[model samples]
Target: MKLLFNLLAFTALIFTTAANADISENSLAPQKEANFAQNYLDRFMQRDFDYVMSLIDTEVAGTISPEKLEEMHGYLPSGKLLSTELIGSQVKVINDNWEGSFTFEYHFEDGWALASAYMIRTEGKISIAGFSVYNTPDSQKELNRFSLSNKPLGHYLVLTMAIIFPVFILVTLVTCIRTPVQKRKWLWILFILFSVGAIKLNWTTGAYHIKLFSFQLFGGGAVSASEHAPLILTAGFPLGAIIFWFKRRSLIGQKKKTQKSQTELKESDNSV
Candidate 1:
């Protein structure tokens, strides 16, 4: 009985080991495809057109000539390849044909990167199926620095003034029409003129080119001369409005005080 039980246990262990080995090999299959896809992409980006075309599917290669492929690469963004990393991949098997695709992020100098690659397999051999270039977000380090830099200050100034001045004009127009204070109306007109100056600046820089059609404005995001202008313009409206509000209130207070004193003096004189 002891011998039989030991034999059974040994057989089960061998089966388990074989099953685990098979599972590991199956799981690693996709990773292998992904690596091949990355390699194909690297070769193409390096301008090794012959080597890349050799690995492509025969049918696909027939459709894309060597000259057309070179032309496509010529239009790609001008930058040195920094690095490439495989992000994800997909594989499918249908009717004896294997299709595999890999997505990779290609990082480049000057905060440039794109994610695009695909691989396919025919008769158990992997080959480059497709390639795409999609824009990726700027790195946080560069985005923060450029968005805050003083160069884009004018862009921000134009954007802020563009957004706020319209509301400022509306409020001013309403006040001028409804109020009897002609003196204050002129001051409001001056504010309107200041707003107009901002609009003009924005127009010259093409701020409305984006904000007019789409509410999503890049403002002064890119590295440019007016990068810091956005920051200043962001604060300009509220600060200017607050200061003007207080000054107008004080003027109104003084006017009322003068009128009250004059009335009291006339009453005293009449009684006398």
Candidate 2:
């Protein structure tokens, strides 16, 4: 009778263990869905196009070229991946399959961070349903945050500087040309010619477009002052003006001191 009771107790224990295991797996299933969405993002950044393509639904993949697919989803941003975070995710049931939307934020080597969205479906596993190519809403928000339109003070200051700079250069050239000393005048003229020529070359090539209302200067249509040539031209004028003003002040002070000393010496000689 004791042996029969022991056998019954052992069978109950086995059944209990199995039930617990099943419950544990059921609890993990939701988490696995989130993980699959995250893993898809990781593989895309890793440039595992083959694995990524395999995950896409055949109907979706049929509509786009493989080359275009890679271009849209690959790590088009150059540099090392600094870090990645899963910001949010949503999953819904559609015709017995899972549809998931995931947002991931990535910080790249260049210190630029962007959020990417992945839309996918899963039949026991996840597959790409669709994805944003360029200018996703998150990306547009980021661009707007850095846009000149958002920075009123900086935008106006740049505009003011751009207008003042060319006028300042022209004034300096006129001063040099009008000087009476023949040798000094010619040398100044040559220097102004070369300098203005270089500045114009940079302005034309740097492709900086300074816009205030309807007027466009430097780069036409849609170029910013941050471009190489525009940057140089933008910075050069203001910096040169500062240096020239200070140097001229020093020269004038020295000339006044020299003239005062000479006047005192001549008076002293006359007294003697």
Of the candidates shown, which would achieve the greatest lDDT relative to the real structure?
1
lDDT of 1 by residue, 193-261 (tens): 332111223222334332222121111112122221211221123333344555665656676777789
What would the TM-scores of all predictions be? 0.38, 0.36
What is candidate 1's local distance difference test score?
A: 0.51
lDDT of each: 0.51, 0.47
Clashing pairs in 2: 206-229, 208-219, 209-219
Query: After superposition, which runs of candidate 1 have C-alpha atoms over 4 Å from their true positions?
Result: 1-29, 134-272
Tens digit of per-residue lDDT, candidate 2, span 34-112: 5676677677667677877777777788865668767775435667877665544556776886666655556666544
Clashing residue pairs in all predictions, respectively, total 13, 3
